[model samples]
Target: MFAVIKTGGKQYKVAKDDVIVIEKLEGEAGEAVSFDSVLMVGEGAETKAGVPFVEGASVAAEVVEQTRGDKILIFKKKRRKNHRRTNGHRQDLTVVKITDILTDGKKAAAKAKKAAPKKEAADGDAEAAPKEAKAEKPKAAKKAPAKKAAAKKATAKKAPAKKAAAKKKED
Candidate 1:
């Protein structure tokens, strides 16, 4: 199954066993995270989309690793003004592995109600299944502030490089 989950003001499409890199999330490696803002869910040949988000639908995942991306260089110059600027940046990222997709508890409850009448002539065991699925989900933790130290360091290094390069061009 596959699911669309929203977090950190972004949306990501994920599936079981898939590894995805996203904006940093607060948690140690191997810790579990459940995304309750599931926008959509799908199984073989069928899909269910939510109006904004499906109530009770969720995607469970594990934090795999934390890392940063490659540095990007920014440079600006003005002609005959001796004015120039240079900087570099890198973004922190987190890798996660998708584990499972849980159906909306509300949907399951509604379905069970519809299905109850047909199986009623046999037993009451079917009702128990929905109850177990309705158990509470874990609450999400607050996100940690991203560090800008790398960007500051990169800027400090690049300013000298830019000055040296400009001098070489003039020579």
Candidate 2:
């Protein structure tokens, strides 16, 4: 059976045990990931299509490796302008092996368990010790008044000089 799945703004036609290099996905090697945006599923002459996405249809895969594509050189030039720019880029990619395709809300792999929320303490116990407050370090001492005044005077002197230089350049 073959399935068409959409992920990372692209569609791929995949089948069981197929290895494909796709856009980067956040998962470690050997981690299981499911693609729920199934566009189509086919087996021999029987084919099932989705209006947008197939309801309860998903494709499961195992992350095989995380790698990058080949570097592509980008060059830009403007004739007679003495302007030229060059850049190179390599796209992040993930290699995955398609494990199974499931329909009708069935899951092919076990889902990760969510963390349980912490319980709050009851209000009736007055003897229950309150949560300890975080200790904050003392703030640094302020600069001396004489030093601050000197710094301010230095900046004030430089500001007018900068303005004068800018006006001279414009003229």
Candidate 3:
């Protein structure tokens, strides 16, 4: 059976055991992921489609590896102008192998739950925090250069004179 699955803003026709590269997904290699936005499913002449997306239909896959797509060169220029830009880009991708296609509320394999990390206290650090309230250090204030401040005051003083001169000229 073949299924049409939507992922990474694109649609792909896949079947069991088929491998495909899609946009970067949050999973490591050998981890299983499911695509629930199944658009269509087919077996020989029998076909089923979804209104937007099929309800209770899903495709299960295992992450093969994370990879990058081919690099694309972008060039821009304007005739008679000395403006040109050249750049390149590569898209991040994930490779996955299709494992199962479930329909009618059927589920794939049971997913493994990740264990939470345990917190360990250092020697005497845990006892110190509860016994004493730590005081915050004062941040150092930034100081501006005296030369720049004087220059700014000189400019401010000259601005009124310049405006007066402009008014006299206009009159």
Q: lDDT scores for all predictions?
A: 0.76, 0.84, 0.85
Error of 2 at 38 (Å): 0.2
Model 2 weakest 10-residue run by lDDT: 132-141
- Which candidate order results from sorting by lDDT in descending order? 3, 2, 1
Judge candidate 1 against the unseen true structure and give its global Cα lDDT, from 0 to 1.
0.76
TM-score of each: 0.58, 0.64, 0.65
Question: Which has the higher lDDT value, candidate number 1 or candidate number 2?
Answer: 2
Clash pairs for candidate 2: none
lDDT of 3 by residue, 43-133 (tens): 9999999998888999999888989999999999998999999999999999999999999989998655332121234343777655543
- Where does the lowest 10-residue lDDT sum fall in candidate 3? 113-122
Off by over 4 Å in 1: 106-171
Residue lDDT tens for model 1, 1-171: 889999878999899899999889987676677788999898889988899898779877778888898899999999999999999999888998887777846321111223346457435677766665564332222222223665667778754444433444553
Model 2 ranges with Cα > 4 A deviation: 111-171
